[model samples]
Target: MTAGPDRPLVVLVHGAWHRPSTWDAARSALAALGYETRVVALPSAGRDPAPTASMYDDAAVIRKELDQVDGPAVVVAHSYAGIPTSEGLTGATNVAHLIYLAAYLLDDGESMYSRHGMDVPADTTGLFPLMGSPGEALYHDVPRDVAARAVEDLVDQSLLSFTGTVTRAAWHDIPSTYVVCDDDRTIPPALQETMAAHATATRRWPGGHSPFLADPQRFAALVDDIIRSR
Candidate 1:
């Protein structure tokens, strides 16, 4: 689906411990569909002198990007980035739609940590060892083989990012879509189902947490359809 002369922009936001490169496949697909796409990289999960790109800080960056775009834009947030995107686009005028991909969708004034504390299974805590110092807690959960191949791609995230509270709920106003990965090991499939129940439309795929990397073509098509419908 294509928009008018003022085509809507598609802003892709990567979650914690991930860089914008995570969405490389989706970015190419979206670009082929004639939509302007931009993938914003957040602070890594482990940086020596970590930048001030907390989840909230990342939201500010997204807000700035939204401001520069004309017409409505679709903001897609994956995993941890969902919290910030939800808060960032609350009153954002340029955002017409919001998409959450195996991501947390918190209510106003809620933080990812608090939400995770409530929703995550108790048995999943031991999945990764805690590292870093105060104010910078980072965990690694990918399988050893996967991590070995992709660990270099992971970035350090600020503990402050997860602790930051979202002051507003963007989905309350914008049309929203949730893509649930049924085989997601990082985030329990049950949790994804619960979150998808709250979205306007839900699409399910058989894959792990990184569906954009595993199956970008289908994922991109789903996003394109949403844009066309709007």
Candidate 2:
């Protein structure tokens, strides 16, 4: 879909261990709705050899993308992307709304590891291992072949991305919505609810973690509704 001036551009932010290409389907769907979309490639993901960029670095990348936009934009952050998205969108006037899709909605000084009930590593220079079966955990509702490909494309995430804390919580200043994926295996539904308290509103969706992969068109429609309503 071509760029349109009628609506805000949608910016998609991917989670840890995933590439910006993961938003391809979601972007296409949003484009069909006459919305232009941009995907942010985090410096913390898909790094060479050992991962070095932290979530703060990822936040800078996101902020740079937002700074280049000529008009308003809405950020749709998925999973770990929420951490940087929260920090990055701070003081970003062009971002009109934030959508946390089965993603974390943490406050200032909160790290991903600490929110997950895990201890922050003293040494964050190393790579954080991908835990459990990502295919089942992240894409259980997606097709077998697509999920397999997604798992194959996964990379080592930086330890600091998870251990690092956000200095600013954009959701507090920006109107935000949180979508809780009930069947999510990666981030439990109960925990999602707990974090969602900081959002302007909360919604529950019946699916696993990666709903965009499960149903791109529907996901895009939901995003459209949220953006338009704001």
Candidate 3:
């Protein structure tokens, strides 16, 4: 866990109803801060006709990305993406740290659908869901124009991603950080606090569920500070 001058690659996992492009601003900002970045295009949200992708599918893709990296990497999971990221980082030797940003931090055998003991959003039948516009699901504090662009790019999410359980939780082994968006609408801050207990370090921000979209420069600085403090 010692800090190293060589910046590790920062791999970003966007939540449900999102694409890898969601991390565009953060990727640019991180690069400016001297950190290489990669974005994961989760398979669960893909355009395939059959219901194929699950949490394991997404996690396997992430593990492949981790295996390909030559040096240590930091994996940051946003919202629902945490499920896949956590399960994916279980045996990733190249991962130096794991970061959860207002994300679902599920224990082993736990599915996103059962989080807080809530009912699953859809039936067992394959379903694709859309994200809420602007303030409803995220980006309440962001400029309207910015939020609009984000909403316009939303993707349909597979219900399978929610039902699949994680076989492993990366936070148990890797040095981990959790960033709680205090005003998050998607994942309540109270639940986020409950999950924060497992992280090596925890931070709070007054942003919405999608804080990186609200202000990537500030979010990037916060992530940079985290790496420095470690």
Candidate 4:
């Protein structure tokens, strides 16, 4: 299928502790469907020689990518990615739409830690503490092999990223759709629903946190449908 006027470039932003490769399957599926896509490598995610980048740095990277897009683009932000994506897309005219896949949608001056009613933890080793048993929390619904690989591919997220609050909420101006993974074990579904209230639209999916990993083709189709319906 040819990309229509309404079909914008798809930019995939992975969540914390995840690299760009996490969207490999979904990116391939989108490509097969004739959709051009870009996956962001979050500097705050996993940095060699330890990470020093914060959420602001991550947002700058996203802004740089959006600046390069000549036409309209749709940004898909997953989990923690939503934080930087929201901050990054502020006043970005090229962004046609935003899809938050089981992600947080913080408002201006709010942060992940603040949203949860917790104080920002002190930066330890310049990274956030990795969750225990990620395979169970993130990929319980995924295939055994895929789940294993996903766990192995997980990396340290910069604590500064989470501590940094959003300066602007892109969702306030951009039309956005929030996809809530109803069965997500990482972020509570209730919290997902709560955050979904901030979006232009919301969708609920019966899966774990990483739907793209569990079923990439189906997830890509869902993304396509959402973009088209908009």
Candidate closer to the true structure by lDDT (higher is better), 3 or 4: 4
If scored against the real structure, what TM-score would every candidate get?
A: 0.80, 0.95, 0.92, 0.95
Candidate 1 lDDT, tens digit per residue, 1-230? 23343457788998777777777778888778777787776643444415444666778777777777777778899988888788777788777889898899878767766767754333421112333421112113334454454555665565556666778788988889888877776678898887787788888767667766655677788788876766
Query: Which of 1 and 2 is ahead in lDDT?
Result: 2
For model 3, how does the per-residue alpha-carbon lDDT over 140-226 read when each residue is reduced to its tens digit? Answer: 888799888888887667677778877889888899999999988778899999888889999999879987888999999998888
Q: Pick the candidate with the highest lDDT.
A: 4
| Model 2 global lDDT (CA atoms, 0 to 1) | 0.87
Query: Model 4: which residue pairs collide?
Result: none
* Model 3 regions more than 4 Å off: 1-5, 47-50, 119-123, 131-134
Please list all clashing residue pairs in model 1, or write none if there are none. Answer: 44-155, 44-156, 44-157, 45-155, 45-156, 45-157, 46-156
Kindly list the per-residue Cα lDDT of model 4 for residues 34-145, writing each as its tens digit. Answer: 7999888888887451466888889999999888888889999999999999999999988889999999999889999899999876543467878888899999999999
* Model 4: CA > 4 A from native: 1-4, 47-50, 122-125
- What is the clash count of model 3? 0
Query: On a 0 to 100 scale, what is the lDDT of residue 156 in model 2?
Result: 73
- Top TM-score: which candidate number? 4
Sort by TM-score, best first.
4, 2, 3, 1
Quote the RMSD, in angstroms, for model 2. Answer: 1.9
True-vs-predicted CA distance for residue 145, candidate 3, Å: 0.7
In candidate 2 the C-alpha lDDT for residue 162 amounts to 82
Q: Please give the ranking of all candidate structures by lDDT, highest first, separated by commas.
A: 4, 2, 3, 1
